[model samples]
Target chain A: MGTEDDVTPVARPGRPYDRSRDAQILAVTLDALAEREYEHVTIDAVAQRAGRAKTTLYRRWPTKVDLVLAAVEAAGRPPEADELPDEGTLRADLLAVVDSPWLGGPERRLAIFTGLTSAARSSDRLADAVRTTVTEPYVAVYRALLQRAVDRGQVAAELAPRVPLLAQVIPAMSGHRLGATGEPAGREFFVSVVDQVVLPALAHPPGPATPA
Target chain B: MGTEDDVTPVARPGRPYDRSRDAQILAVTLDALAEREYEHVTIDAVAQRAGRAKTTLYRRWPTKVDLVLAAVEAAGRPPEADELPDEGTLRADLLAVVDSPWLGGPERRLAIFTGLTSAARSSDRLADAVRTTVTEPYVAVYRALLQRAVDRGQVAAELAPRVPLLAQVIPAMSGHRLGATGEPAGREFFVSVVDQVVLPALAHPPGPATPA
Candidate 1:
């Protein structure tokens, strides 16, 4: 998997640490986290895999939780508000998120999520980290997308308030699939969820305007 | 928490086993499971807690996985189709499921789910057990409820085909909450999901009939 990107050193402020070096180590950490339970993932192993000294990892992250959280945060970079896909229709906009890089591919991302979720079950800090890094960013992106649709008159203005909850539908289902089945939900499943659940819910909100 | 029901031994066929005794043991197992991870739950501890001999417990359930699977199955008895809530509205009927005994109360059910889900993340056997014991039954109940609505002309007939997929929304979200935060998704949260997501999705499914 080594490419020219692995050799390219991106600049960062505050310290002399190379951003690409941090990215490289974090990527390795994520791969290890994806493969095994959190307790089983040792910093020594990550350092070895990343071709860095264990002391260097300790100097950077100090704790396994810190390292893991950093890796998760790095990998889960949701598209910025300006970067959201605008495919004209609300459905298309949402569908675009299914394959978005922020989600990663089906295999690695779900495995990483499964590992982190299992860890989160015992540690409140890890749970909070996941909510902040993984869930919230995705939720924000969805809310932004939904807001865009609302502004364009693609979705009802009355449904605007529900953007927060509605945004969670896909992420919740994806989380559930990994937790319950220990497998990644594929594109077809996401499509089914968006089409059969999310869109329908948006279209048929039980508001004052609805008939009894 | 001990009651007269704990002392009552309901009769069961085969090997002269008492149904109530089995129920009592399973309840204890569920409680322990709720309190900690699956790997930490020992048969000897369960036997001691249940007031049964270790030999007796071994004779019945042979392994930890077997015992756990049995306990989960015993707890998750979805109501019969005829027993579904007929509140005369699809929304009310769906909401009634939130408070159903089969789901248990918020605390115990969610905790048990978190434990099972964490275990499921590592074991395909446990994952399958959860699907069979917990998820499938709930899905069936939801499908039945939705079908009942269709029969009553409450939900559109065209939405019948998506019943199975639609039935999964609440369970998936609930599963996500436990897995991500190790917390029960509260009644308020369930209400929001139903009002904002499930019902709306049912009303607005994507089909050929939908306007471009």
Candidate 2:
């Protein structure tokens, strides 16, 4: 259900955008996010921490979700384009994601994502930003991996329509589970995720997208 | 990392336990949880909203996780077991979950789960509570579904270790995606989830719990 006159505020061009202030706000927001789960964080606290008045914060962020989203996007280090692996098989390429430092090491990213999702239950725009900024990197890697797989004919060309679901589910499940439980997404979880979930879906021939 | 040598303050038995007070606090916490994402909510705020002293809130809850867990447990409507579908095959029984109103309805439950998980990134007890209380109902249904499948010889024995992963991943993906994107976990999504991820894992021959 959509709400409010607008979920995101348009920049009024009232003042020049200050990159330094942007960075500071994000840094403070990230600290606050790390300190407490998203539900406990307040824009006022973030503003207080950043040494910016609430108006200064709102001028750019427009909404609390926008502010938090910007912070999380900044905190997350996107995989470098050069870092994309071209290991021969589709499996090896996808394994790069499994083995990637970006996805595996930090507890913070998962925590941040989970926190946004909890809020996203009510805010549609927050969810969009998450998908675009946070969910996009892995999705890009998955898309590349799948494109390579399809190019090699390792998977049927027909699997294309369903790639949206397939791409993010791994990161979504793995990250969410770890974020929620403090359990490391150990090698075992990754391997089973690949073998039991990802691979199986690919192997099964597709019918109509809708299930009976 | 363990924090203050003593975070959870023990009760002094100075007064009798007030069940009504306990209910009021939980109701307030649940409302707070429903109103905002977990990271943004604070104990002080919850206390203020509940019109209770912080000491009184802490006397019962001890930790933030403890308070939130109690609220979520209270808010989630326990599945009316009679509602479980007994369709002949395991798949049908499991499908009942996708069709169930509890998972599909208002965003509160998913919000509660996501918030708990975000905190759970740090708190082991909170994680246990989430899996135990929030995830347990579905896990139980999945266990029943799998037992029926194993009994019918529709699937092999070794799939047991992986059921935990299989059962929750759908809700995790679907709910997280919706929460983040404001998109519905459409029937098509549910159909694809079962077809692509779940059925294949079951059909694949059992191997060691961890992938080689």
Candidate 3:
């Protein structure tokens, strides 16, 4: 009677199954999230809204947090390392990343951020996924960029080895959206920070890095 | 009988009922926070622990959120505009603030941060105060420091002018603690960020400011 059975890939023969059905379910999850807070949104309600059987929803995601996280993931992939800009300079690369339209806007990012934080507090598995999938990957790309600068002798060899890459970028980018009334980061802001602040601290004159 | 009153300033006698006793009450509120989570902590519990009357606590704060906020305020002020380090350079100054010992260690900051975010979800006043008093002060100091740089012709012209600076330093400083793994900010790490990442980004020559 419904598209549920058709969309949901059935499990092998007698085994449990469904792939396309899961996608529809995840889409419905997003719709439900928009309509209600994460705490109030439930699996039964999601199934009801999707017009799918309750068992189908449970089979895909074990819990509401898992479902919510899956929906977030479905919204977009993390900015891939290769997708990062490298215009032969660090400043330009940072600006590109900061201003990328594909990246979720401040409001959406804030929602994901708060959701991640809450899920982390409530469940360890979600925390692990966030660290491995989101935090670490982005940090690695920046660290790689810094490493390239260090290799080119554009920055002090010691600088890239020690800096907390994620710490520097995330704060400036997320500050305002996270309820800070500060000026939002943009191309000039990114460039200024890179040129005025980052480069000076890192450009060792072919000597030992000084004590901070 | 209680030292809470002694440690905290007393209310004035006549002109108006001094709100100073609220400070005393909040001190005890912090003591309670150290022992319990936000859900478990209560205003009556705070009054009982402080040896102050419940009516006195209610008269000043009126709600649990207000009481907790007063405790946060009484804990100490955020870094002041003048207090931002001025070691003849912006990089050193920023490193000082990020690595300041008086700001409380990472764990304590995380606790306060988590508590505040959790409270803010439900209470508008708490949310506003967290943004205004705690978050804005730090952002303002950063903006002021950047403004000083701009004045020195060390940074770009037309930088976004605002009371709360949006350049990302605040988030970069706090992100690690608030995020999943919750790492602490250290002096050397901060210096590297200020030097390699932050200084270059903010400097005028658009290159490294100091030799690494």
Docking outcome class, model 1: acceptable
- Cα error, residue B188 of model 2, in Å, equals 4.1
Candidate 2: where is the Cα deviation over 4 Å? A1-36, A39-69, A73-77, A80-84, A98-127, A156-162, A175-188, A204-212, B1-86, B96-135, B180-183, B186-188, B204-212
Model 3: chain A TM-score against the true structure: 0.62
Local lDDT at A176 for model 2: 56
DockQ, candidate 2, vs. native dimer: 0.20
What is candidate 1's CA lDDT for residue B116? 80
Q: What is the lDDT of residue B164 in candidate 1?
A: 79
Local distance difference test scores for all models: 0.72, 0.61, 0.57
Q: Which candidate do you rate higher for DockQ, 1 or 3?
A: 1
Candidate 3 achieves a global lDDT of 0.57
For candidate 2 chain B, the 10 contiguous residues with the lowest summed lDDT are B1-10
* Tens-digit lDDT string for candidate 3 (A1-212): 12233344645876655476566776676566544445677899989988988887787787888787776565544464656577766555555555554424433443444555445445456666666666666666666666776787766665555455533464334434435542334444444444434444455321113222
Task: Kindly list the per-residue Cα lDDT of model 1 for residues B17-76, writing each as its tens digit.
Answer: 655578778888888888887778899999999999999889889998888877766665
lDDT value, residue A110 of candidate 1: 65
Tell me the lDDT of model 3 at B129.
77
lDDT of 1 by residue, A132-206 (tens): 877777778888888887887777898887788778778888776765556667777777777777666777332
